[model samples]
Target: MKCIIVNDDSEMRKTIGKLIGHSRGMKLLSVFNSTSEAALFLRDNCVDLVFFDIQMYDVKNLEFIQNISERTFVIYIPEFSPFVNTTKKPQLEQLSESTIAKRFKKGVDEARIFLKLIKKEKPDILDDYFVI
Candidate 1:
């Protein structure tokens, strides 16, 4: 999957970029410090996944998130992000600190797990995947 990292912290961006680079079945497309910049890139291109940071230094991500295509999947990077993981969307998931350092070392296991869920559930943005 083609992906990008958008984080206010350059260090974090670098870290995630390196992780993505080492990830299996994943490619690092680009990295951005601002949500708007990432949003602009998302407009003309197609990416299978996005690694986004909820806490940004310049612009808020709410509008940016709204601007992206529904087909794209979002993997939130911040542990303190505002989103509550109540949805049954297979494309959405949060990163935990315990697994951050070992994420890529484990061959992008988290992303692999999420992608497996996506394949099994096929959750779309417009509709709920689970009805029960």
Candidate 2:
């Protein structure tokens, strides 16, 4: 899966980039320090996954999420406890900072399954795969 990281923290970006680089079937496409930069990239490019910092600027507006395509999945990285409402949005998920490595791996695994189901055109089971 092609992926990008958008975070103001350089260390966090590097960390997540490395994880993506090391993960099988995953590619690190690019990294952005701001939401506007990522938005500009997304305007023309479509990636399979995005690792977005929830505390980043413009995140509160939620315009960024609305701008992306439904096929794209997002994993929100929070500096603290995440409180975003993920209710009907199966494409969106939050990664706990305390267990980032484990959660990230799980998210990637689930995304892979989701993509496979999408490729198989199994819409019925898609809803069952994502709890929230």
What C-alpha lDDT values do all the predictions have?
A: 0.65, 0.74
lDDT per residue, candidate 1, 11-31, as tens digits? 677767866776567788888
Question: What lDDT is reached at residue 19 by model 1?
Answer: 69
Q: How accurate is candidate 1 locally (lDDT)?
A: 0.65
Residue pairs clashing, model 2: none
Please give me the total number of clashing residue pairs in predicted model 1: 0
Residue 67, model 2: Cα distance from true site in angstroms:
0.9
For candidate 2, write residues 1-132 as lDDT tens digits.
Answer: 988998877767877887788799898888988778888898888798888887776643388877866677778776543344455422222544446677778878877877777778876864565422
User: Using Cα atoms with residue i matched to residue i, what is each candidate's TM-score against the true structure?
Assistant: 0.65, 0.75
Candidate closest to the true structure, highest TM-score? 2
- Relative to the true structure, candidate 1 reaches a TM of 0.65
Off by over 4 Å in 1: 79-98, 102-126, 129-132
Q: What is the Cα-based lDDT of residue 87 in candidate 2?
A: 52
